[model samples]
Target: MFAIAVRFDLHDTAAAERFDELVALTVPGIRAEEPGTLVYTPHQVRDEPLARLFYEVYRDEQAHAAHEARPATAAFLEQVRGLTRQLRVELLADLPS
Candidate 1:
């Protein structure tokens, strides 16, 4: 599977919540629209409340590319433009399950 691991540091706790709200909307839309999206999970760090993590798994590079091209993704990016910092994204190769 092709995966992406993402981490974000929000400007504040409030921004984290706002960003999560944006994700809530985006994730469901992706699930409904993209059959190749296998997993899309968002997590909040317990030790650092302002930190957000996302684990996304797709069928292949094409699936991942399709996800990035979605309108929901675009809207989500626009929504969080100023709410985050120290954002990191890692493209991963999943081990055999």
Candidate 2:
């Protein structure tokens, strides 16, 4: 499986609501369109109010590539452009079970 863990700090707490709204729109669209997407989970950090995280898992490299090519992905990226103070993403390869 292929996965990615994304973490970010927002520019301000006020941006959190807009961020949530975009995620809500983006996740459902991805789920419906991408059969190879195994998981797409979004989290809001409780203690760090402006922090957000997303854990995404795909069936394989091709699946992940396809996901990035989706329109929803572009829209989501655009929405986050000015809202984040810091952003980091880690691409992952799951170890054998």
Candidate 3:
């Protein structure tokens, strides 16, 4: 599996609101259309009202590439750039079990 975590520091309350709206619009597509998207979850940050985080897992690198290739994913990335003051993306590596 391939995993990634994204942190969004939204510009303000308005940006956060817009970001949430975008998420609502975008996730349904991800859920319905993305078979290789094993898990995709968004979270509101504790004590940071303007912060949002996303956890995403894919079946493999090809799956992740397919997700990125989607038009909705492109649109989501474009819209979120305006809302976010800072965006941090981490490519996660698994630890030995």
Candidate 4:
């Protein structure tokens, strides 16, 4: 499986609200419409208002690429650009189960 981990830092409560809005509004669409997506989850650090994480899983590299190409993903990216302070993305190969 292929995985994507995104860590984001928000500058303030407002930024965090925007982050939350994007995740809630966009993720379901990605999961429902993208066949290649195996898992899609958004998380916030416990009691930490400024930190956010996204955990994504796909069947393989092709699937991962497909997810990246989806319109919903693009929209989500564009929407969140100014709403975040710092964002980091990491791609990983899943360990054997």
- Winner by lDDT: 3
- lDDT (10s digit) by residue, model 2, range 40-91: 8999888988999999999998999999998779878988988988899999
- C-alpha lDDT values of all predictions: 0.88, 0.89, 0.96, 0.86
Ranking by TM-score: 3, 2, 1, 4
lDDT of 4 by residue, 53-79 (tens): 889898888998988898888898888
Using TM-score, give the best candidate's number.
Answer: 3
lDDT-based ranking = 3, 2, 1, 4
What candidate 4 gets wrong by more than 4 Å, as runs, is 95-97
Query: On residues 29-66, what C-alpha lDDT tens digit does candidate 1 reach at each position?
Result: 88889999999888987899999889999999899999
Q: What's the TM-score of each model vs. the native?
A: 0.91, 0.92, 0.97, 0.89
Report the number of backbone clashes for model 1.
Answer: 0
| Per-residue C-alpha lDDT of model 3 across residues 29-69, encoded as one tens digit per residue | 89889999999999999999999999999999999999999
As a whole number from 0 to 100, the lDDT of residue 87 in candidate 1 is: 89
Each candidate: how many clashes?
Answer: 0, 0, 0, 0
Q: How well does model 1 score by local distance difference test?
A: 0.88
